[model samples]
Target chain A: MSHDKPAWYERARKGPFVGNSFDARARQAIEKRIAGKGDPRRRKSAAVATWLVGAAAVLLAVFIVVRLQDAVPSAPSGNHPVVGAGTEGSGKNEGISAAVVRAEGTAETGKLQVVPLNGEKQETLGAASCMGKETDMQFQGSYRVVYTRGKESGVVIDELPEMTFIQPSADIVQMTKLAFADADVFLLVPQYADCHGLNFYAYAVDKNGGEAFPLSFRMADGTESNASYYPPGELPAVRDGQLVLPSGEGPGGETANGPQDRIFDLNLSEKALVQSPAAMAGDVTGDSGKKALTRSFVFSGQTYTIPYPGDYAEYFVHAAEANLFQIKAGTKKKLTSFQEDEKGIHYVKDGRTFTAVPSIF
Target chain B: MEHEFLKHMTTMDDASLRDIMAQYGSDIWNYAYFLTKNRELADDVTQDVFIKAYYRIETFRGQSSLKTWLLTITRNTAFRYRRSTFFRKVNLFASITSIQSGRSAETEYMEDRYVDDIWDVIMKLPDQYREVLVLDIRYELSTEEMAKLLNIATGTVKSRLHRAREKVEQNLKEVRS
Candidate 1:
């Protein structure tokens, strides 16, 4: 037999004994944590609308939806916490840590938009259009939540689980509790990830109103699946314009190394608002779907006004060390902010306040 | 306790099975974990090895320590881990459980999560190369023992060892620069 050897990786080892230093204690620890922190939505939160009467219905609906979108398990969830390679149980981890929880911010007054890094003239996801208009979203609070950052190609969102984990391709989806026109929609812009999928109930504030809207869909290769998720017209936060086309592809299915401005189509009917008030300052919309929603921040010079993405509508008016603003609508007053609390907003504001929103971040 | 039990334990003694496990459990587990890089998988392999040991203890002709036999099983189990991937999608262990061990806020903002990345690279290596590399880096198993477990000649084992080390060195070079 030829004795020609492989490489150093074939022979060199870090330890000497077979299975000597690995700590058996870590086995149980990891299992416990994963089972515990599988999904942030599983836990009880103050912001998410949770009630007993609708709990069963929520579960049933989410089960049906997530089972439809079979997402890849390894992809990070909405604003997913990354799983990095550390030294095998090494006592000291010199590397930086990921933030699990923090405050939020507010920047958009529903008027001006711009991308700092790219120097591109950006538009509020609110201004985009899709196959349909943005209407009231009717989903249960207890329903499953599938989330992705910006991966809206190939895999259909319908095949995911209620708590389906998806890649941040270029879009996001959520299960709404209730929907209404002129709603705090921009808050629906998922934070962190470029794309995400989610399922959460939106309250009509009136409680009596029903906001049942249609859904939309597209593939990673920019191919539109016949599966229409939401109705046409109303636009949310980040609408990859390309997806708006009936054929999920760029104009005539063109591909390029440059910008595909129309990755997802807004095709929204009305406006969606964040349910909660904003806090902190280090929050500014960043690299949203193909159509990123970004604004400059004075803090770290840049902050994400929008959240990575989740079933919950996120709003942060005062992002820690970022920026803040309080704006006005016709009959409604909105405090557009970035709130990563997973509940979206915290402080409450009435509908009638200002004519046009302000800018800060 | 395991040595004494290895000398005299009976199969019907269910309690002895656990008793024996408590003694050499860490050793077998270490072997399995290093080979698999996943704690849960290691635990599974450890369980299987001990269960087999419990029944086959009577077959020990005193040729090797119980640790050696179990290590052989661990190596074999590692191989099976790779082979089983063919039946699944992108078959490779992410060591996600271990990845979570260091989960925290500060690590996320860091330039790179080295621990997670390192495991990512480990999982990407070919099975043959990965097995040898994990065995060396994690457990430091000698070529002789690896050969015995792999059921190959010592020279062949050395060749694999040599190749595994080279691949790791080249990988380290890329990471360092």
Candidate 2:
């Protein structure tokens, strides 16, 4: 060693005493302490005395937190005004929102094609031919898609495949990319082709401009079915870093009382797709209490009025089942059911303990 | 020493608490200060460890020395302080400002004209390795004692300490050059 160990070790050992020392303060505090002169009644009185002070401190903390939260608002609640879902017959110059659809077998022309979203037979998207099978495809903003096919890779820009050829291998394609904002999230879909028809893969991109890794999903149904997705501006807006993707349609097709579409909130940072209790029915107006009801809840200082679909009682049951929201009364408990009257929705956990909803959702 | 601490704490008297604080307070503060590299945090952690030790003394099964037990509390408290929302937000703001200013610790260290002692280089090591090195050098703790404190295998502590020393030495050589 260049320098002797003992000299530097001695120096480093004294590093804590360089500027500040806690001994005097500690010695003073410890010396002034009167050891356990046991009095339960006095202890109880002391507790009561401190309780008010603690409560005031807590209230002050809460007030500051609320004020700070209000200063920086969460995503605007209510209807997510979509920029546009997709524009049909619009020129390439016009902003065309693109989404990748898995082609079963091949098209009528005996090649993979991108048809209009309206189920109308239109011109295929890219002019470039696919060398092999493409799967786990997703739309990048403005008619561009980052996709992988067999071992070949390409970025489809302006309806043209910028293709790169690579030797096909039996190994499953485990990596796919979702480009949102400036950067991309490298997702590990793992055998994406075989499970294309099974589960909907929603990619929540981190917009803060770094390559985010790991993709997760919340599968509502156990069985496999045809899966579809909506790219960025198509569905409910990404609120407070939470992107709600309508994963799949209900088993019941097109009825007033039919099962509503299951929606999952994709939080990329947490690497979790939380199944939300809210179903995807059309635009839910606040006054329209038939399909969904708008119940306003104050979080921090900001008031968020989201459309609550289904019975208020059923909503709590589902919410508890999903573990999406938790309520704290005396003790923290997942709510079971709720009732609404003159005050607000009263959420019940055990038969006895009932607190209002939106206290801490 | 461990038995003596246990006997004193069993009394739950003023003198017992004072004795524990007098004996272990400086060591705990040094450990915390080295790990956090912040005097304020080290002071807070030292106080917190003593308070926690007072409440949770009954649970201290006497398997480890009182010093190790207290140091364990100090480490946990230090980490908890780091993870708090206020600390995280402050750190995030500092990071953003530092990023904007184009001033990183790496750049600052590389720019340092004078080669200081090994402590400077030791502070530059990653959190895990740096912590192990601090405990090893500052306290001269055995591998078993470290594993008990850190809740890791003794092998991990040994390897991390070795790696931390190597990195510190390498950085020191670089600075000297």
Candidate 1 residue-wise lDDT, B75-126, digit = tens:
6555455333222222233332222245366643451232334555665565
In model 1, the runs with Cα more than 4 Å from the true position are A1-361, B1-23, B33-40, B78-124, B136-141
> Which residue pairs collide, candidate 2?
none
Q: Please tell me how candidate 2 rates in CAPRI terms.
A: incorrect
The weakest ten consecutive residues by lDDT in model 1 chain A span A111-120
- Superposed on all Cα atoms, the candidates' RMSDs to the truth, in angstroms, are 27.1, 22.0
Model 2: per-residue Cα lDDT over B1-177, one tens digit each: 544557233225556667788788778877886667765566567767777677545435455577877787787687656533232332312222210134378754553322336666777676668888788777777766775466443544555676677787677678879
- Which docking class does model 1 fall in? incorrect
Write one digit per residue (lDDT tens) for candidate 1, span A100-216: 111111112211010011111111122112211222111111121122213321211111111111212212233222222322222222222211112112211211221222233
C-alpha positional error of residue A3 in candidate 2 after TM-score superposition, expressed in Å: 17
